[model samples]
Target chain A: MKLINKRNFISIVCIFFTLITCGKLLYERALNFTDRYYTDNIFTILGFSVLITLILSLHFYLQKFPFWLVIIAQYALTVGIVFLAIFIHGRFSTNAPTAYWDMFVSITIPFLIGALVYYICFFVQIKRANKVLEKLNSEE
Target chain B: MKLIKTREENLEENYLELHYDKIDEETNAVLDRLRDTLRYIEGTYEDKKVTIALTDIFYIETVDRKTFAYTKDMSVEIKEALKDILEEYSKIGFVRISKSVIVNIFKIKKLQGDINMRVIIFLKNDEKLIMNRSYKNDFYKRLNDLKGRSAK
Candidate 1:
């Protein structure tokens, strides 16, 4: 296995921390919107979000495949994580069946937003690199 | 008993070995001629002193009516037009991949498809070059020819 450089390690840590904090605040807001509607397991939701965030970060950092693969993987992982969160919460209540569609929509919206953000970041990086290359070539 | 009686034994190697040596010699001579021609071209351009390895150059591009050679290390401005360079090096694996780009087929790391029939060429150094729609057919033909030659 390749050792992570200090810069990349720090970046990953920052990303992880930021995602966790935001996820916490969002979870709180979600709870406020429908009090006692979700499973009282904050840890489970946080765990799922962290897992998804790490996967997305890995995809972004490595970038082993083509751009299309990266985008597809990001969307798939985000959607999967959202469903996992709903499943984890729904397991504890008898009202789980009734909340299925509502849970789907709630989970999906955040993931779509996150995917769009990820894509924009990826595109911007590519554009910047291309511009640098163009400038270097132009100098010659 | 009959074999033992024969004055000359059977040849250990096949006749193909002799032909292979001749082909090798011919190939080496051709390569030498190509190198000499490239050296002559390099001598003609006095302003730019460049030693471009066949393996290092990813492609050549024309920008703002000036032609530049793009290598892994750096891009070098060439006084010669793209057509002149293409004429000289196309025989040695360089190919016109687009209107403004002529790529060394050996330096391509991977090929990716962009939207609307365009393709992106990823060089070994991680730089991306585009293959325009118009030159796609000719590009592939040249690429295939290089692959065929290499395989032999």
Candidate 2:
């Protein structure tokens, strides 16, 4: 399907980057405020970004997948990324919560936040698209 | 261009009569253009033949080697191949976004694209289609053409 417009794609990618970067900075600030500083190794940061970039690239490339499936897979990736970050910071067995409840909260919280951001972006795009469609219809 | 109106009580249904002397190639072409705009495509749907206006169709898809023209509520299999559909309506906003589908750009409601260069097209009727990367450029080119004309 040629449903993806190049201009829209480029714009979405730019927005996603901005959102993630801002999210990371705020998260770090919150951590510092709480005196629970998560170690930020340069290599670990690089790896995390790389893995996410690759997964998102794959998700976009496989555009035939249904929206729900994509969401599920993305949530799963979010869990995996959180685990990776915990492991890399060497706090998996130390500062981290080991109970199932804690783990569940950790994963679901970020997943919900991520989902919210995604849906917000989706709705914004929809509104923009509706305006564009209106223009196109007027021209017709 | 000129018009001459006359009241004729014998006319039953508002008859239109054209009076021209020494009609040239240009006039002949104009007649063809008028016919093309009012054209209907004869097709078959569910084993029954139907005629539909070309502009009313949302898109055309070739499934299982058979081509189908889809409107808001029905799908009619047309005798014309995919290539024929492209040749016929592309100039009027029909665009090929995949190997098997030619969507009317005017019918698309939303277009979202991601980093992988894939696009999701949302139709006004709520149907969604992914614009494969392979045909992405063509879709954009046609879209840009529409934008250009609109700008003018």
Q: Which is the leading candidate under lDDT?
A: 2
Over 4 Å off in model 1, which ranges? A1-140, B1-48
Compute DockQ for each candidate against the true complex.
Answer: 0.01, 0.14
**What's the CA RMSD for each of the models?**
17.8, 8.2
Question: Top model by DockQ, which number?
Answer: 2
Q: Give residue B70's error in model 1 in angstroms.
A: 1.3
| lDDT score for candidate 1 against the true structure | 0.59
Model 2, B68-133: lDDT tens per residue? Answer: 989989999998998987887776678898889999888887787654335778887788887765
Query: In model 1, how large is the Cα lDDT of residue B95?
Result: 78
lDDT of 1 by residue, A23-128 (tens): 6568779887544534443444455455555665564354335555665676677667667666775577454564556545544665677667845654554454
Each model's lDDT? 0.59, 0.68
